[model samples]
Target: MSEQAQQTSNSYRSGPDERGHFGIYGGRYVAETLMPLILSVEKAYKDIEDDPSFWSEFYTLARDYIGRPSPLYLAQAMTKHLGGAKIYFKRDELNHTGAHKINNCLGQILLAKRMGKTRIIAETGAGQHGVATATVCALFDMPCTIFMGATDIERQKPNVFRMKLLGADIRAVTSGAGTLKDAMNEALRDWVSHVDDTFYIIGTAAGPHPYPAMVRDFQSVIGNEVREQITEREGRLPDTLIACIGGGSNAIGLFHPFLDDPGVAMIGVEAAGYGLDTGQHAASLSGGKPGVLHGNRTYLLQNEDGQITEAHSISAGLDYPGIGPEHSWLHDSGRVSYAAVTDDEALEAFQLCSKIEGIIPALEPSHALAHVMKIAPDLPADHVLVMNMCGRGDKDIFTVADKLGVTL
Candidate 1:
């Protein structure tokens, strides 16, 4: 094992230190020009970190605007079918803007408002984050620009339309296989250029310093809610927690609050587009080695020369070559298990969920469901497994239709 991986910690929650590193995985590695901006953001977050008023305002919006305490619904039909673990779905998909992305967006926009930022820019893979950012920009009357890969824009047309309808300028990035990495690269370039009045609200739990940690803090509402709701319902913590990972915001959000709980096991599912052996998957932790990308050190899919390779997945959101640094730390620390689900498995789970549970899940969370299908049947019936239903499927109908050979 690497020296960093062998290191032990007393608390999983105490991370990123003051320098924003979770062991060796996370740190600020941006250009010198962006260093001041990064520090400014870190200071801003630290200033409000202990402020109850900020949290009060945040929770107020979460409850009144974004709809908090999303249901922890037992998947009775699915549970019976699987005949092993009693499945529960954390219905984050029911939140406004139709995904968990808004949870982080709401928090970041509030931060931006506090920082007196007049404009917002963000990068998106599936366009859910763009829609959420646009929704908040409209609410707060800020001009929003979203960087999206050209490939993703075409695949996630519905979300692109949603972003436009909400008054966001969509910049289609055509570099680097036209996926999430390219979108993020363009967004970073934009941030470096427009540092005066613009705040780049990164959509995921990757990127430099405060971003991975900040995004996780905002998203932790998922795990916090699950803890309260599950204890109320089952009188105990769950056995396993599952969520699909792109940049790992949703998974980290759902897993962070449970990191110290010894009884709770977490699984993060990566998008294995094809088989891992075929070199077409996005399973960074499973298939890639540690590397620095988009500012933080993390597991990234790269070629022998250290050039990043294109990641392929049917789900636009999971089409990234790197994972969040925190996830990389958790993987190395053995606190959480990482698994990969392929396009076919995710597609099957999507249809199965729609047909069996009467809930149409977005392609992102279908990866988690596919893993649930794999292990749920082998465990005891009393095993309580909760999977984050991170998004709704409305934005992915066209993509699914094409894959299934059906006309929309």
Candidate 2:
């Protein structure tokens, strides 16, 4: 048997061991100065891991603040259009701030309060996480600083305005393609310089120990909800699950809950900016190799000399060079399949869904929908498929309009 098959033959959910090593993919590899802070964050998280009150507050906020149990709606029009598997949309796009980013933001902000950190720092790409972080900070009256790419700020102007309206201090990073990776680099630098009073909430499930796991645990609400809702409606679990991945928070959130279910398959769609052949894409797992970045060992788009390369994606959110370490492990272990969707394909799917379902999906999740379009028609009609509508496309209207040559 293959090593990957051996890894998956056993339990799939028990991972990241004591030191947060998910089959050598996840580990804390930070500077010595940040080690204590990282360890402290880990300890604090461990203390609240099984605490009833902490989770009580979390659920209460999920229900009242961010809108929990978003919805599981079968896309009858899209399903009939596909003429194959019944497609169900996990409506995370309907959440507060119009995206699934609010789920992780809410959890980490609460943790920040528990840690007694008075200031919050975060990195954003597509700006949804920035808006969500700013929203939570506004609610708690905590000062927030968001590091976003100058490029992303221009393309995602609406979300930038929303973040500013929420009173977040927006720092535009101009280094390294001026995208998500650069924004994350700036956020980490800020965290190290002001470690005393600031809590850095890394947006995705990509960062060092406790973060990838912590983010997954918080976002797992999506998959957990899918399990209950799908079983209630369909009387069985979904046959397949799909979601887009950059640092892979949303995809991991939906797939983690069902990792041990051998019968259920999961597919993670990565952004192929132009096409994989052009080397101008962000399909890390499909095109990159394992390397340490943002403090964890994961598949990264790097050159032969081991320098990280720039990733391109029409969707600002999926423009990262590496994925979350857990996702790297899952991809290697063969528990989840990774696919690439080109910018053109995603753009087509974006418009198709908007016209058919009246649900304008963000460019990120549109990548997943593109893959679903490719395979759904080939599957049996009774086959059930669930895809995470991770974010709304209102933030992308301008970008879409420009791409379609319709000036706004």
Candidate 3:
């Protein structure tokens, strides 16, 4: 291993324990009926983690199929525009399916195949995960089902059609304002009913036991590559790492590899929909308390009666009532800082990046860019900030056009 890799490996010592508790934030908060199946999944994942062949196949697909080692580009235009920090983008948006969602999907589909599963089920918000799952299922020839909110289906119609074109069954969930959390609830119910032949492909770094940890391990490829790439390019680690957080898979993917680097500031940007004061946003860590949701104990947006509140964001991807359990733990432990970006702020950054960098970012990463715009101007010119460009904006043009009062 290289010196940086060795140091990073040594530094990451605060992972979850055997029971998947990340300092009391992550644990199996699932139904009793699903416990045995979850345990079986945990065991299967343990076996795969210890097997070299599993990784060989996974990495082979990552490189040849899903396109690994996504470019880390110095956004010179953005840097000059900001006029302070030297900004870089880890362009996972260039990957197949136009998002980092493929990274976790590729890993989970392989695991599902190994576990002898024939059907795959997943929940998505912005439709990236649903589209990614559908793509992988087509590759593996496994029947696929995607659960998405009715609102999301309308907002992300292009991706919904893409999922259909990929031969996956798209189920529209219509409960609780019909958004991400409701879609997840519906997917979980389906999983419980079809446990024999189905594997639930959770899109984010949240969920019960092995799901969060497993998803993080799979998605950590983003951080690992960033560590190597940035080290080679700058001969040093980044000063700050930024990514948008909904369920926080992409954020954790970028943040996990740098967790041990105390000098590297980790920032997760959440959706501030209208603003935190309006109670219409999805800034879970900023405005929420500890609660159990979706089979994991994490920071959640809930009422006094412990009811999960609806989340709102212009970016369908960042609309969530709770974040990943690991992120909740990281926030409480002071290992990472959480910030909120309003819809208007993200839209501004979205247009700014398009005009300046020629990279039309999806609204998800636009949230991260919004915060980057906020702090980059104040930092030293020599300071480096790496942000995850997790998704592209092609699927989001309709929403953007509609929001800007333009006729399609």
Question: Against the true structure, what is every candidate's RMSD?
Answer: 1.3, 1.3, 3.6
> How many steric clashes does model 2 contain?
0
**lDDT agreement of model 1 with the native:** 0.94
Residue 16 Cα positional deviation in candidate 1, in Å, after optimal superposition: 1.2
Write down the lDDT of every candidate, Cα atoms only. 0.94, 0.94, 0.93
- Candidate 2's error at 64, in angstroms? 0.6
Error of 3 at 224 (Å): 0.4
Residue pairs with clashing backbones, model 1: 16-21
Q: If both were scored by lDDT, which would come out higher, candidate 1 or candidate 3? A: 1
lDDT of 2: 0.94
- Name the TM-score of candidate 2: 0.98
Instruction: Look at candidate 2 and tell me the lDDT of residue 5.
Output: 33
